[model samples]
Target: MKKILLGTICLMAMAACKNEPEKSTQAVVAGESTKAPGPVEFADQKYIDMGKASLAKFASGDIDGWVSGMANDVVLRWSSGDSIKGKEAIAKYWKDRRMNMVDSIETSKEIWLPLNVHQPQSVESKGIWVLNWHQVHATYKNKQSLTFWVHLDMHYNSEGLIDEFIQYVDRSVINAAVAKKK
Candidate 1:
């Protein structure tokens, strides 16, 4: 009878402890902002389609179509710190390289992601941005071929036209390959 009574008392004590609220173990830092992160909108289909179409136009030698979606004051920047401003200048640059310099260019393993950034850092603008990654097989006019991965970020203005394009790639490898003679 004593053992039964002791077990019942232990169960009652455990039940009382279980009714207590849990205490947080996380330490609170002084002056730390408890702000929540900004909202992120993912996979806007139109931007993805536009990005894919732009790349397709470029690979198929349709320079005009590729540039048609760009804003009038578009800016294109390369990872090598080279930049081309204005839609006309960007078109000219692409024409010269695609028509005269490159014989054939093909893209594989392409990925496109579109996002609307509700809030961004000070250096970034809040708008639609499309991110692309692809493996390119490019043949120079000199018959030299190179296959490399490329990353590009295209920022679109409110009118759904691309205003900023940033291309990230190793320019040295491309320059060396282009400089090679047949």
Candidate 2:
């Protein structure tokens, strides 16, 4: 399952990036290793740190805190086909982004805690896999359910901050939590 998912994401990335971020794998000369990282440099430690910081702030709804992390001119496209650009646009999009749930509804933390830990992904020629889709299995409350990994592909921005996210989790788990109201 994991192998199949990764193969699919690789194919998709190859197709989408064919006309875009066309695989730029330059030879790492001795002199090039010492230079500082650019804003969109996702492979470097700094880029990962900045991206994670932005996500942490975004999750907390600290707009002022995370806004600076984004580039002035940025474009965001959702799987739903809503495309937005610029800082103001991003801010406005975030305004109503909060989720409200009933008493029986579960917290995101509850669902995520079990699925968040993962093995490191190898760096390919292109960008890193920001949200590698893996599987999560659940049984009874007292029973110990295990995870069998699957491939889920998610995309982020050049700055390393996640501008997009799409995951293929267990359909049963996702539908129970995100199904439209009757």
Candidate 3:
């Protein structure tokens, strides 16, 4: 009985915090101060679609499709300090190396996206969380399946589109999986 009661209380607390405006280290999404260049609309369905499309393409190893899905002037911070500005250059990197290092890769994008609704008008982020994707079993060109977790410190744009895409999968997992062959 006590355990059940405690669980219920914790559940209520978590629910109450769903919309509690936090993670303002960055600004809100819809802070359109009446004058900002290309002020993006917050909670934009279009943006979400773009993200969903990009995620699908990446997971599927569709390099061209993934690049096409991003905004022209994309500001990508893939890691804590490794930031890649502009979609064109980023595209080149993907084409050169990251595109087909593997023959195929699968990810559970939607199932892993953060489901936080703690903000105003979709422009303001009530909070942020680390998005941990399901295990990705990627098959290399030689048909070797390497399993790893794709974790992202996701940031949503004004359109509720993920402007910044970061990947935090443990490379060691891939290394170990591949090491077994050699």
Candidate 4:
């Protein structure tokens, strides 16, 4: 009985397939894309060079050189939601911190990526953005040392100067290290 039922099912399936029309197997013709063009991101070596030079300057205590490519009204943002605006103020703040608190800053394993956004999306401006990742070994003036990784993003304006800067780092470790007394 089971074998006869199986034979009947197979015959019914074959009849149904025989009655259906064959489908075309031709490849689809290509056409224009329907999606709107999104942001265009590409690398430019000049931005990478600038980013590296700035970091080198900072590590060597060249505050002015480090900020030379920054716009007069540039803004610096940290991962902690704290921010500092204006070139002179930023320079002053970094200078004071380095001069008073830090003894040395050494960076290694540097990686730089430069991106040019020809078309931007919401809240994003069209410009050149340089991203850098490095390890920082810092020694405080009180003879305390701490090593950490840092990620920096800098956006350049039409003048090829950085107008906005963002840094992603955890300062809590450094804060604790600094708060410890010798």
- Tens digit of per-residue lDDT, candidate 1, span 135-170: 999999999999999999999998889999999999
Ranking by lDDT: 1, 4, 3, 2
**How do these models rank on TM-score, best leading?**
1, 4, 3, 2
Tens digit per residue, CA lDDT, model 3, 1-182? 99999999999999988986665475546844545533223333444455556677877767778866455666666434567777787778767655445667777534444434454355434533225455676877545687666665455544443455667656666756655553
When 1 and 2 are scored with TM-score, the better candidate is 1
Q: Where is model 1 more than 4 Å wrong at Cα? A: 1-37
- State which candidate has the highest TM-score: 1
Worst 10 residues of 2 by lDDT: 105-114
> Candidate 4, which segments miss by more than 4 Å at Cα?
1-38
RMSD of 3: 15.1
Best by lDDT: 1
Angstrom error of the Cα, residue 178, model 2: value is 7.2
User: C-alpha displacement of 4 in model 4, angstroms?
Assistant: 31
- Looking at model 3, the pairs that clash are 19-118, 29-123, 30-123, 42-158, 118-126
Error (Å) of candidate 1 at residue 180 is: 0.9
TM-score of each: 0.80, 0.38, 0.52, 0.77
**Alpha carbon lDDT of residue 74, candidate 3?**
64
Better of 2 and 4 by lDDT: 4
**Which 10 residues in a row give candidate 1 its minimum summed lDDT?**
31-40
In terms of lDDT, model 4 sits at 0.89
